[model samples]
Target: MASQKPRILQDTRDMSWSLIPLVLLCLIIAGVASQCSFSPGGPSAGPVPTFDIDAGLEYDAKELGFPIRHPEAPEGWQANSGSRSIITGEEGGDSSTVGFITPAGRYVRFTQSDAGEAELVRFVAGESRTATDTREIDGRDWVVYGEEDAEPLWVADFGDVRILIGGSGDEAELTTFATAVGEAQPLEP
Candidate 1:
């Protein structure tokens, strides 16, 4: 028992010594993290999170409940985030929402849903809508709705689903997004 006690204590001392380098590495990492350099900016300009478009599509495409297409933006435009969204107060109100950033850095989004045009427009805009004008692109008709004081909205309907694209973007940005959506294909990574 006496010999066993010394052996155990020696083992513990050896293990403690072996952990010294690991502890130092952890301290170095923490110090490096604390000293990280960032540009001068307020919280209003915090880093935006990037989302996996392919993964989000894989998840939302399975539960869209209606046949709809997802768009692939041209270069310089980026898909920001996407997920499956469920709208309450309506039966079978499952929807898919995808946010994007325009080439000029404006934020935009498209909500694909089985809801009616009014419901979808209200959901995307979250305010009263003003139908401005009609624009035809690639043989499809889209109605423009928005306010000068708020983000503009573009609403279009496929045969089975309603698409409401709205964002803090102008008619040109929205038009570009709508064109991509209209020419969308099956999701691919």
Candidate 2:
């Protein structure tokens, strides 16, 4: 056993060797980072799904036991989706919903339910929102809820059924869809 160098010096050399793996890891990470690119907006959305409002309304009308109206697709607008959902809370019932993509690429969702106006508003715009104003669309009074926000909800009572329309479009675009839906004849269930 030749006299070994001081334990501290021997340990220092071992420590330096131990750092090699960490250095390599750092270099690998740097290389990966250099090759990585970021998109601030993230991935783009795919095309909207095609939905047939006629068949859906027929089914919903029979199943939901309520009147379901199908608005004629406005120019450059299309029905992208439709579904049936149960309205929860005190006014528990089924609802039929149809989503349209406007000409400007904005979305408007139309929901028809037998639920009361308050429950419909609560379901559509949340409990925190309240009736802000009223908009007359095609001689029909559409109660505006949460109008101060970017997307406001418009609810109209059509006798036994209540219709709620809300979306990302501006007033004009929303009004256009509302008018179409309001003026359209109810589909025979």
Q: What Cα-based lDDT does every candidate model obtain?
A: 0.75, 0.83
Worst 10 residues of 1 by lDDT: 1-10
Local lDDT at 89 for model 2:
77
Across residues 1-189, which tens digit of lDDT does each residue of candidate 2 receive?
A: 768677766776688898999998988898788964466989776787788888899888777778888887679888899888777878767888999888788998899999888877777776757788999887899989874545888999899799999889778888888888888787777
Model 2 backbone overlap count: 0
For model 2, name the residue pairs that clash.
none
For each candidate, what TM-score against the reference? 0.70, 0.75
In model 1, the runs with Cα more than 4 Å from the true position are: 1-47, 89-92, 186-189
Query: Lowest summed lDDT over 10 consecutive residues: which window, candidate 2?
Result: 4-13
